[model samples]
Target: MNIDFEINIYHEDYHNAGSASSEIKKYLTQLGLNPKFIRKIVISSYEAEMNIVIHSLGGKLKLDIIGNHIILTSIDKGPGIRDIKMALTEGFSTASKKVREMGFGAGMGLPNMKKNSDKFEIKSSPKGTIVRLSWVIE
Candidate 1:
């Protein structure tokens, strides 16, 4: 079966930052996706979802399940990262003080997402940013 869906995410919407990932988890569970794959997928999805809330002006979290591949893509609008390399570093972050106070922004989001996915790709510009994570079911 193939599944595709998207959740719109707003800027600084901490209250709903995790909703997209949570919904994805429900679908994966209902589909009986492997537990090991679910864990990584959820992790990457959560991180990507959170990044949109914490950084971009607005964005959407998109999920696509095609055959044996599960992919999650976060596409955000405006104010892209100044330094992709630094952003991918384990301890680097540009999140605001309020976000840090909210117990996020410890700077592990990108690295964690990358580590948990079978394939990861990112593209950014002043106009927007996109992070794509893919996992395969064995």
Candidate 2:
């Protein structure tokens, strides 16, 4: 069976920062997913959600459970990343000072997301950005 879930994220929505991941965590738990796999998915989802809040105008996060793999896709609307390579680097962020003051922009979001996923891909342009992450269950 295949399952899919989607959540909308608004820019700078600190109030709902981790809600997407939290809800997904509950869903995975109810499905009896392995703890380690669920942890990775939750961590990556939180990072993606934060990225949308910190960077884009808004976005939607889609999670799909197909067979033994979980797929996550985040698509956001404008102001896109100027440098995809740099954005993936640790300690490199374009978040404003105000965002930094809130202790949310350490530039670790993308790196952490990639690190937690078995497979990761990112694409960006002047229009928007899209991030895809997938993990397999063993």
Candidate 3:
């Protein structure tokens, strides 16, 4: 069975930061996915959602279940990353002081997202950014 889920994420929507990831968790639970796998998915989803909320203008989190594989994607609209390499490093973030005061930006989001996924890819430009994370269920 193939399934797809998508959620729109708004910029600086701190109150609703993890909603998308929660929805993903609910759906994964309903689908009877293994708890271990679900944990990874949820962690990645939360990180992705938080990144979109804190960093981008706006974006969408898309989850696709194709047979035994799963793909989770984040597509944001504009004001992209200036340095992919630095962004991937832990403790490297461009979060505003206000955002940091809220304890939401530790610069670990991208690194955690990539670490939790079986496969990860990120592309960014002045226009936008896209992150794709994939996992295969055994």
Candidate 4:
């Protein structure tokens, strides 16, 4: 079966922080995905979602399920990361002081997403950023 869905994310919208990821988790659970795999997907999705909310001007979270693999894409139009390498580093963040004081932006988003996914790719330019994540069903 092939499944595809998309969710819109708005910048600095803390009111709906984890909603997209939570919905994805529910869908995956209903699809009978492996528990561990579902957990990883949830984490990855949450991170991606939060990134859009905190940094980007706006973006979309796209999810595609094909056969034994699940694909996640976060496409955002923002200032973009000047240094992708540094952005992926743990304990590195560009969030504002307000965002930090809220107990978010510990710099763990990208790293954790990469760690939990089987495949990860990121591209950024002055115009925007795109993050693609893939995980294989076990």
Steric clash pairs (candidate 3): none
What is the model-wide C-alpha lDDT for candidate 4? Answer: 0.94
List candidate 4 segments past 4 Å from native.
none
What TM-score does candidate 4 reach? 0.97
Candidate 3, after superposition: displacement of residue 47 in Å? 0.6
How good is model 3 by TM-score?
A: 0.97
lDDT by residue for model 2 (24-109), tens: 99999999988988898898999999999888999989999899888999999978899889988999989889999999789999
The lDDT for every candidate, in the order shown, is 0.91, 0.91, 0.94, 0.94
| Model 3 spans with C-alpha error above 4 angstroms | none
Can you tell me which runs of candidate 2 are displaced by over 4 Å?
none
- Compared with the true structure, what per-residue lDDT tens digits does model 4 show for residues 1-138? 799999999998889989999999999999887898899999999999999999999899999988888999999997899999999999999988999999988999999999999999999997899999998887
TM-score of 2: 0.96
* Tens-digit lDDT track of model 1 for 27-48: 9999987888898999998999
Give the clashing pairs for model 2.
none
The collision pairs in model 4 are none
All candidates' TM-scores? 0.96, 0.96, 0.97, 0.97
